[model samples]
Target: MRIISGKYAKRNLFTLKSNATRPTSDKVKESLFNSLGQFFSGGKVLDLYAGSGALGIEAVSRGYDQAFLVDVSGQACKIIKKNVDLTKEPERFKVIKTSDFRALKQFAEEGEIFDLVFLDPPYAKEKIIKVMNTLLENNLLAPHALVIAETDEHTDLPEVEGFELKKDHHLGRTKVKVYERT
Candidate 1:
């Protein structure tokens, strides 16, 4: 896969060979970013369930200051490191090899907050709500932080009290929802 826009636009990224991950398609990535404001000025990002670190890398490429890419798979973590290395600014990206919950807890304990977060867990084991709640409870989301959730079309995410659903669209077989903190 390749970055679609910004400083690292068109830069190539590597994907894991295992069937455990599904990299977000270029078309969907472009659409999702467009829906989230096309580009960012500068802010931190978290890519939970990061497959190839594409989403977080794209955010950094498009002007986000830093990104934390977390994945449970060893292969995925290696691929994410390789992809971040391509940017030539590895310092801007941090690859964490751990489960999503553990990563969230670590970030929370460290008083880390993000301006944006990408949640694209495997379709079968969707935990968007649980993750969202953890982020909220831990104060790991900056005021008005934006969250982009990618899921199978069959999944439906309910509206939570502290978040406002900004956009909800179906792109092919995928469902993309953008939520902003209230």
Candidate 2:
């Protein structure tokens, strides 16, 4: 896959060779960023289930200050590093090879907060809600932070207390939603 816009526009990214992870398609990525106003002035973003590091990398390329790309798979972490290296600005990204929950805990321990978070997990519905709550509980989200989730059509996102559903888009079998902190 390739970056669709910003500083790294048109740059190709490498994905893992396993079926356990799915990379967001360029169409959806483009449309999602378009909905978020594409380029940003500065902010920190987290790719909670980062597979190929594409989404987080794209965010940084689009002007976010930094991106934390987290993946549970060792292979995916290596691929993430390769993709980050391709950007030639290694400082812009921090790749974590760990489970989603563990990454969140680490962030909490560090008192880190995010302006945006991506929750495209293996199973979306339950995990997404849990992560949202964890983000809220730990104060890991910046004021009015946005949480974006990409999931299968069958996974329906619930109305979490601290977040307001912003946009929901369905593309073929994929369902994407954006939520903002209330």
Candidate 3:
């Protein structure tokens, strides 16, 4: 896969060799970012279930201040690091090899807040609502923060109290939803 835009536009990224991770396709990534205004001036990004770190890396490429990539798999973490290094600014990314929930808690403890959060967990084990609630409870989102959730067509995400659904669309078998904190 490759970064679709910004400073690192068209740069290739490495993915895991195993089937455990599903990397977001270029077309879907392009559409998702396009819907989010195509670029950012400055902000932090949290990439949970961060497979190959494409979402987070893309955010940094597009002028976001920093990106924190979290994944449960060791191999995925390695791939993420490789991708981040490819950006030539490893300092802008923090790669964590851990469960999404645990990372969320740790970020909360550290009083970290993000302007953008990307969720693309394995389709069969989607826990987006719970994760969103955790982020809310911990005040991990900055005001008007944007949350992008990518899931399979079967996974339906409801509108939660604190978040306003900005856009929801289907790209082939996958579904993409964007939410802004209310």
Candidate 4:
């Protein structure tokens, strides 16, 4: 996969060649960013299920100040680090190897807030609402922070009170739902 735009546009990235992870395709990533905003002024982004770190990396490429890429798998973290190295600006990215739950706890402990968060957890283990509630309860979301939740078309994500549905995009079986914090 490769970055589709911004400073790192066209930069090729490494992806895990395993079925355990479904990296977001360039087409969908581009569409998602376009639906929101292509470039950012300055803000931190969190990629909770950073399988290939593509989404977070793409955000940094598009101008987000820093990206925290968290993945449960060691192999994924290694790949993420390698991808970050490709940017030649390793300081702008933080790679963490941990489960989604632990990552959230760590973020809370560190008082880390995010301007954007990408949640694409494994389809079968989806608990988006719970995770979002944590982000909400812990004040992890900056004012009007945007969240992009990617899931298969079959999963019916319920509406959360504090977030407004920004965009509901469909591309074949893949569904991309963007929510903005209120």
Q: Mind giving the per-residue lDDT tens digits that candidate 4 earns over 58-114?
A: 999888999999999999998999999989999999999999889898999999999
Better of 2 and 4 by TM-score: 2
Query: Which of 2 and 3 is ahead in TM-score?
Result: 2
Best by lDDT: 2
lDDT of 2 by residue, 104-150 (tens): 99999999999999999987899999999999999999999999989
lDDT tens per residue, model 3, 107-163: 999999999999887653348888888999999999999989888888888777799
The residue-level lDDT of candidate 1 at 169 comes to 86
Task: Report the CA-based lDDT of candidate 1 relative to the real structure.
Answer: 0.91
TM-score of each: 0.97, 0.98, 0.97, 0.97
**107-181: candidate 1 lDDT, tens digit per residue:** 999999999999988643348888888899999999999999888888888887699999998999999989999
lDDT of each: 0.91, 0.93, 0.91, 0.90
Model 2: lDDT equals 0.93
Off by over 4 Å in 3: 123-126
The positional error of residue 95 in candidate 4, measured at the CA in angstroms, is 0.2
Candidate 1 TM-score, C-alpha based: 0.97
